[model samples]
Target: MTFIALTKPQMRGLLAKRLRFHIVGVFAVSLGIAAFCKFAVAKPRKKAYADFYRNDDSMKEFEEMKKAGIFQSAK
Candidate 1:
């Protein structure tokens, strides 16, 4: 039946109207997630890295290793 199948023009028109909205919505959601990750998730990770590097014990170990000649000498 004609009602069961969409005509070519009907399909094309429907796609043309709806596809742009879907694309824009998807783009917006992706941008939001990226921004959230950058501001929310990345901040704590950066803080953790900074704390690890700045800890007294870590620095002491690093200096000890350097003094022990654990690292390769630069030519």
Candidate 2:
């Protein structure tokens, strides 16, 4: 096994290559976090409410309350 010492230019090139790899890694991690938040942290409020109100009994009760002016805004 032979030990080799890097020259200044070689060291500079190696450092630049490592810097580029680090930048790419940071961007990849950032994109992964963004994608995770986009997919995993989203709450489908409209769809959830639609599903909740799709039940027949609840729909009937809501309509009855509306008919009784329970949801009317005061003038």
Candidate 3:
């Protein structure tokens, strides 16, 4: 087997040639992670918020706020 040595210019050219594919690979990976977060992480978080609000007692909260004097009655 023969070993071949690349000069700095040749190495730079090779890196430049491969840069597009590297950039595309990184972009694809970023898109995949975003998709996973949207579907897996965000969906569950959204559902949890929905469930919490669905079971929330607005009247009870209003009474609590009234007791706490958070609202001022306008004369």
The lDDT per prediction is 0.83, 0.78, 0.90
RMSD of each: 5.4, 5.7, 4.7
Output candidate 2 Cα RMSD.
5.7
Candidate 3 wrongly placed segments (more than 4 Å): 1-12, 61-75
Candidate 1, residue 58: the lDDT equals 66
lDDT of 2 by residue, 1-75 (tens): 998997655644798899999999999999999888777665565567778777659767878888888887621
- State the TM-score for model 2: 0.45
Ranking by TM-score: 3, 1, 2
Task: Give the range where candidate 3 is weakest over 10 consecutive residues by summed lDDT.
Answer: 6-15
> In terms of TM-score, which candidate is stronger, 1 or 3?
3
TM-score leader: 3
Models 1 onward score TM values of 0.57, 0.45, 0.60
- Residue by residue across 1-75, what tens digits does model 3's lDDT show? 998996655644787779988999999999999999999999999999999999999989888888888889921
Residue pairs whose backbone atoms clash in candidate 2: none
Clashes of each: 0, 0, 0
Q: Write down the RMSD of candidate 1 (Cα, Å).
A: 5.4
